[model samples]
Target: MAHAKVKRLPVVDHVGMLQGIVSRADLLKVFLRDDDEIAEEVRREVVAYLFAAPVSAVRVDVRNGVVTLTGHARDTSLVPMAARLVRAVEGVVDVEFELMRSEGPAEPMAAPANGGENLSRA
Candidate 1:
């Protein structure tokens, strides 16, 4: 199976699943409230592992304790590998992945114009 990049989906608690209620806005709020620099650092670490594994078909974003991964991998079987990579990172409380299979070449990831540098000292 070809590897594809995946995006992180919103995670729901066991109770929320029973209720069929959970919102993306709520997840976003949780992400935004996280320590910015710490989140970024975790993201970087996750990305490093992903790339080093030779699974370059993915992107990572961290907000609060939630981690979102988006991209394509060469092997479908590598999806769990991606998740495991994020989980191994320190301070990650949740892992969400949104990976899709593609028949075509991978698209270029949008780079933040400012390099997403932290303005405040840690």
Candidate 2:
């Protein structure tokens, strides 16, 4: 007599706020494992694109399917552009922009008039 082989199935945790029982297959469909990797790639691509753009001082954060952008830029118009770029990413479901205009100039500091004097010296 020959014995049959048993195949193992994927396990998923369905414990959440929602009521009802969920199986491994159902959970897998609802929460795809590849989603995070895809989202991360999208985030990196968006960040690279934004950094390459003329606009400076732009930050990006991606969680789940939402992308949050917070930072200041010289041109106000660039704020919308940043949001649009993130939204265009494949895995991004939505984009939230909290970008604000820079309060003041970002010019480089000028050297002290005194020759190589330490201002912090007591």
* Best candidate according to TM-score: 2
**Native-structure RMSD, model 2:** 17.7
For model 2, the superposed segments whose C-alpha errors exceed 4 Å read 1-44, 51-56, 103-122
lDDT string, candidate 1, 1-122, tens digits: 01333333445677766434445555455345454654566445544433333335566666666777777654445557656655654456778878666555434433323453421221
Q: What are the Cα lDDT values of the candidates? A: 0.53, 0.51
> What overall lDDT, based on C-alpha atoms, would model 1 receive against the true structure?
0.53
Candidate 2 residue 58 Cα shift, in angstroms, is 2.9
lDDT of 1 at 100: 69
Q: Write the per-residue lDDT of candidate 2 for residues 28-75, one digit (tens) a residue.
A: 453343546645543345443433332236666666767676677444
